[model samples]
Target: MSSARWIYLDAGRGLAALVVVHHHLMVFFDHEMAALIGDESLLLRAFRGISEWNVTAILFFFFISGWSIFLAVERLGTLNGIGPWRLYLLQRARRILPMFLLSLLWAGGLSWAGERNFNDTSFDVLVGNLLFLDTPASLRGLWFPPFAGNGPLWTLSNEAWYYISLPVFYWAVYSKIANPLVRIDAALLGSFVVGIAAIGVNAILPNPFFLFATLWPLWIAGYVYGTSFGQTPIERRVIFWLGLMALVTWSMALEIRSDTLRILSDGCILALCVVLLVKIVRWQTQLTRLHYIDGIVRLFGSVGRGSYTIYVLHYPLLLFLASSRTELGGLATSLLGMGMLIAIAPHLETRIYAHVNQWFALDRPRADA
Candidate 1:
């Protein structure tokens, strides 16, 4: 992918992260916000509308994950050798685990300070989260909930599985196909097959991990798009078709009575949105360069680089503030939280991760070889 395309993706990711954060902030402080700004205020109505996009923002994150992982594997030639596989796994762990552990500790400290039971903070729960076994409350007996009620961590489990499954997906589906088009087709077919199988198994056995398999196709859609990047032109007809599908599935999702069907329809909508977003970005980049637009994108791109830290740490901090009975107003509290995120994210997400990578010599040339 071109640097311009990357800049666009980063901007999207950053904006999505902010949306998610804002949604949670509104949710956690709804009473305070209503008391301060009146529930009927136009500003509150707009905030509610923006907050409703959180689910779509999350699905976008999954799409970006697939695209990023595909690019990383391709650059490292991971599929061609065992050495690259080892390095890839280490790199992924380095990127995710340290900050994840830190987030858990942060949550634990908050729970202790507040004397509030956000959720179970037991040893087993901690271990389960570390193993990426976090799942929805509907699957409580089958898997762990996010540690200390940091609900967003559930997606990390899904993403971790996606990372682990990618190499296996390539070996099983992409290795035998010499033609690029055929490989893409086969991968998509495989994703659908696996998704269907997972849904069937979950229906019978009710496993938490099966949710990962059920949503695998969304990730695959992003990977396929990345592989075909720049080669495919943004066509209006393609966008129209995808938009139609998204609309249909979104309508179905709203009306569907069955939880399983509703979830499936929502997934379909998300996958279509991912495709539509890619086309939109491509079309946007094709337009004549505008300095102001480029500057805005670059600003978002900088935020995107620290998005992981912002995501993992925001909830615990919010919980702490909410429990502390601070004198700050709702807007002030929200602004303070965002300010903290801005100040802390760079150090934790990038500088600390890089420092750990250096300490362990994980980025050494010999390690890559």
Candidate 2:
């Protein structure tokens, strides 16, 4: 949480937030936009890559999350006992659960009131979402969610699991166990076996392992970067960035297999992120200013702070807009949802943070710290 790192992360978060918001908004316009302005237009061509990769920014969020969670856990002090884990969970519950549950409730209620209802949402799916355990058997489905209301919550649900397990990771992976019979090496070996078993089980009941099995590696990269921040050399990082860029540029020219393209593109993006984040973080003073370019960054950072709120609210807004105004409703809803992120998101975040933290006595820093 150094100033430099915060600025970088905030900037990234802001950009991701903007992309995701517009991506969701533009979904209403997906077919229309292409038809209204034919795909041949220069403007459409210009934004093709960005438009395609809009949701990919979720990877960046995960990358930043890995780093941030590590800092928070480390800041909570040593994992001498279960104390750190308890503090981690408490802080997480205080910071995340209340806002998310409240928002989920808000979205669900609105959806039920409107044309849509969770009549199809099984009890397990409902409780899974309510508990932020969307990976439960009841919640599994075709890729992405079948539920429309608050669809963006999938990422948050993944993150909740990540937060809960981070402390276990730090304790079992890095530190010495109190019992000598099980060392870090043994713990890691056991984990590897467990991972394989999980994957096997996922092959049967895929829902159980989808979130933890697939995404943990990406999250772990963040932890690695955070813990080894100073160890990465400047030359290597710069070289890696340049190499990645060149490779990407070259790869785009060639038509590769779908699986290859996905893995290479996503893997490289995640790898580049790790390099960029771990490099020496220099504070961008101009980022905080109100000048035109700098102001844009600041605005992104501002919106980034409330990105989650914006995310949750957008789903309901989309539904409401679609249901209420069939004619140009998408356009109207898009603008209104984006505008609300700017005008009301901050206030909502502040009030919710205060009320929830106070009620749960989570306003203070970790007691371990």
TM-score of each predicted structure versus truth: 0.88, 0.75
Number of clashing residue pairs, candidate 2: 0
TM-score of 2: 0.75
Model 2 alpha-carbon miss at residue 48, Å: 4.6
Which residue runs does candidate 2 get wrong by more than 4 Å?
A: 34-39, 116-122, 135-148, 177-201, 233-268, 277-296, 326-328, 364-369
List the candidate 1 regions with Cα displacement exceeding 4 Å: 138-142, 233-256, 329-331, 363-369
Best by lDDT: 1
Residue-wise C-alpha lDDT for candidate 2, range 1-369, written one tens digit per residue: 445456556666767776777676567666656676787887666555566666467767776777667666777776678776887788877766666776667666666776645332555556667666554232332233423346667777767777777776766666755532233234323443453344445545656334354455455555545655544353344334435443653375265333223433474466565565334223243245425646666767777666667766666666666665656556655676668665787567777777766787765432110
Candidate 1 structure quality by residue, lDDT tens digits, 48-88? 89999887788778777777776666668536867878877
Error at 99, model 2, angstroms: 2.3
Worst 10 residues of 2 by lDDT: 135-144
How far residue 262's Cα lies from its native spot in candidate 2, in Å, is 4.6
